[model samples]
Target chain A: MIGGKGISIWFFIGSLLLLYGIIITIANVVEMVSPSVDKQPVLHELNFGVWWGILLLIIGSVYFFSFRPWKKK
Target chain B: MLGNLKPLLTPLMASSSSLLSLGWVDSLIIIIYFAFVLGIGYYLLRFTKTGEDFFMAGRDMTMWIAGLSFVAANLGSLELMGWAASAYQYGILATHWYWIGAIPAMLFLGIIMMPFYYISKTHSVPGYLKLRFGEGASMLSATSFGFMTVFMSGINMYSMAIVMKVVLGWDIHFSIWVSSITVLVYVVLGGLLSAIFNEVLQFMLIWLGALMIPIIGLIETGGWSGMVARIQQNFPGGDYTHLWRTMGSFQDNPMGIHWTGIVFGLGAIISFAYWTTDFLVVQRVLTAKDLRSAKMAPIIGAGFKMMVPFIVILPGLLGLAVVMPKLVPENMVSAANPHSYNEVLPLMLARYAGPGLLGLGVTALIAGFMSGMAGNVSAFATVWTYDIYRPIHVKLTKKEESDSYYVKIGRWCTVLGVLVSIGTAYMVQQFASIMDYVQALFSFFLAPLFGTVILGMLWKRATKAGGFWGLFAGMFSSVGMWAWVKLDPSALKIIALSEYAKDMAENMYRGLWCFLIVVIVTVVVSLFTEPKPEKELVGLVRGCTELPSEGHLPIWRRPIFWASIVLTVFIVLNILFW
Candidate 1:
């Protein structure tokens, strides 16, 4: 809704990021429990996916809620 | 000490082919990205009813949207991967392109040059030339700009396809066709608006996708100081860590460049010309909602532009510190040496990213490549329709055509441009690296165009004949110098002014020489030719134009205020890194 109305670009960005975050976070959680055979990087023990996913979810949620097209109306 | 740690780092490089495969989660992320972009275009289709809407995004983009898209359009994955590769090959010297090579010119465009472009109501850069310099200059620039832009789109397209092939083991032909068609569908549907929206999204994806490398990389290396220490121990006697200390002599640094070339050729001429004159980026700012937004767009872009090196350059530096069996140049790449310099970004992503993150990284790159191609094709469509086709049509018909007719032509031209780009993508496969190829193309067209443009906008004496001939002479001389070096490799010493100057230095010096040629020729020709009436030159030239003031806005609201802040930070970063 940046230029007078329609679905805001931020909403699109947030929705996609939120969706990807949920998927990534859940997948990483399951992987942490099962410890799959897939080769991991040097700091894989740090579980970067879970934290990075959480970060995306937080940022995306802020954007999505703040600029939600319905809210603008 | 660093040499002793090589064995431990080898396992972390993720050199095995099996590790590159994307799981279902990764595939889902990429699919989602594609769906959203296409949906954006479809949603915007109704808003794009007129020619102005198609070519200019209805001239309603906010500074935030326009500014982000401005930088994002130029931040194609080709450049991301290429510059990261450059950082590895040339060390911190590659950061110059992001900093001095871009920031100063962007600020100049925002604070000084943006007024003329905004106030004149021109549709494209070539449209501005047409207003000031008449048809000869406009046609020449429009043709060349259209040509190079399409070729660039093809290069971007091919580069992405090749990266997909190399990194994910995806089929190159399938990658090229799929990506090109997706871009085509969207651009044809919603035009520049679609491209700008996608570019904004791509900018975010690029950050989210690539930011992990620098973050996790610093963690592994302990920190910036630790990474610097490791690099020093690994490449002892190599001037890789210091930004300016090794810039004194051509032989002192890995890039084999002198400070004069970096300052005069790169920072002064090439960077200024590209940022100020290149329509692909300028068109973004041109879509700003108002005069203030137009002026503010590039300045905002410059701020974000400063941080780009983190994602592009740091990965290359990280690769150097940890990657085993040193990456070789393209010519040296084979079964025995599978890693080339250009593969640095993808290699680093594979090394650090697991299943879900891997998809995001790949999606980011795909977004970069598609947005780049879309930007070029969209720009090409506008220039081709407005500058080239419309002029010819009016000449034949002795009247203007309908807006819908022109819009129809723009859509068709987009399709044709994409087709031509696909052909050019195949042509690019024969080249070793397209970075130098693209740089050479920029020098030929943009460097000279900047000369004609800056003079036209500044000096009232610059006549139509002067602008046309100046542009002709500059382009001819650039191509002539390129041929001179090609026919006799020793001529590089004369052209670049040093035997130690490499391909990168050669590009900068060439841009500098061409710019000088255009200025000298324009000045000489204008002095002999009759000048245009000052009244007629209003809005097109500086002195004759009555520029609109920003009014009594607060100091924080002024463009100059932000520009100064950006400039101060720029100076500080150069000093800190130096």
Candidate 2:
């Protein structure tokens, strides 16, 4: 652990990404329900936000748990 | 290669009206990132008691941490944005900077030079010079390095503000001050430890946040083959996709330079000088916990560096194939003519990213700029304390100060450096050309300093007098050569050895000449002066120093084994593209 409070850099990164993924997925879901009037990308129908968010969540969960400070003991 | 070349700087001048508008979600992501950086700094502060702890991350970084930080230190917003623009302007030829211009030198530093640096236990590059060459050489190096590093940090600050203003329509003052204060608080709290940790975080963020552009871009353009076809169709007969096919003659390529300049000037001299000698990157590797970790760090870095072009270079190429109305140079950009080469990254971000992803992309850019500024400022603090102030303090008082005293000085130096950087940011805002001139000036030092450093490390016969005089002569001639071209623009053709050689070619050839001058002068001076005894050269010069054997490890565990793999990949990639 590089941090004095027992938080590893990996854990920190994981938590941040996890939070971001959740926020993005939730936000995009809201947008899908009530579509915004702004111009979207070429493949806006693909729902890139959901898939990319899920990928981030998967990656972040692995990092967070793998190097969690609680796991150290 | 080693220094900030024209390709890297030209994009900064290209400005347009505010391009991408950020949502509240985007602002939240950026704020969270800032909060985390400061929180980490505060958390690390309890352990940052000693000078070593503050300045060297307590000398306990793993290969991953050091390696990521090493690569991230150079992955500044300027590079990411600039090279993207260059990739649009000059084609795949800009990839030379990340590949041949970097990998060989990174491997050289890890396998050969790290032993001397680690064994000698010098805190900074100038400290190594002081040990081998004497006070005169060290003072010159330290003063120049200290000034240039902090100044570059300021330029980074100013550049980030400009990017924010142009892309997001944020006030320049707000961008500069907020970012500067954030960097100042974190770095002043935990020093290099803070910087290193944030850099590792920045590396991952950059990949995750920016990777969407290339992925979505490829999907938009069909694929690599389809993208290439479109580029060919866009600019008929223009060699924009091939790396080496168009490098045979200056007229054949968009970059307007021969392969000789790329190989000899950039690959041999500039890459070696910057990778091996520049303290900004070297300080990251210097934080490794053990000799094995130290030796393996750059190898790990090289592996990641090879993939950077996917995110950085590909986007620009995709812009060439896809960006409508076509982008123009900075000089050509105006209110009526809005599209500039520098806007390619932001334009692409706007193209592919939605609300949350947009915030993520902007956070990545901010993280890059902050980390780069922190890297320079932290390195400046360490050099200022250990190389410049501490030596003079000891010499003047004729007594060594306490460790805590130096650590205190390091903290204060961090604050001082940031204030200086803020001033420099304002100065740059007033006159943009000053940044260009200063960056070019600093570039002159690296090649010649590399010449002196390599000689001192390998040749026991290199006298102290030879090191100082050689560095002075090399720097003088480098400046002289620059002035020669400035006075008469036609001089570039002669210096770069071709009528069609562009500004980039001139930078490469000038570095090559300065390197040659240092080697010649050092050799001649050493022949006439008294050499340091071989006994005194132990742990400093290669021949006299005994390297720790990695024979106990299995073949696969050796650093050289990994380095060999990286090198093989490098060569294969070159030939693949060739």
TM-score of each: 0.95, 0.96
**Per-residue lDDT of B342-444 in model 2, one digit per residue for the tens?**
9999999999898689888888899899889999999999999999998889989999999999999999999999999999999998899989898998898
Predicted complex 2: DockQ? 0.58
Model 2 chain B worst lDDT run, 10 consecutive residues: B5-14
Q: In TM-score terms, which candidate is top?
A: 2
List runs of model 1 lying over 4 Å from the truth: B1-19, B333-338, B430-439
What DockQ results do all the predictions give, each relative to the true complex? 0.69, 0.58
lDDT of 2 at B277: 95
The best candidate in terms of DockQ: 1
Looking at model 1, what is the TM-score of chain A?
0.88
Tens digits of per-residue lDDT for model 1, B276-335: 999999999999999899999999999999999999999999988987778899899887
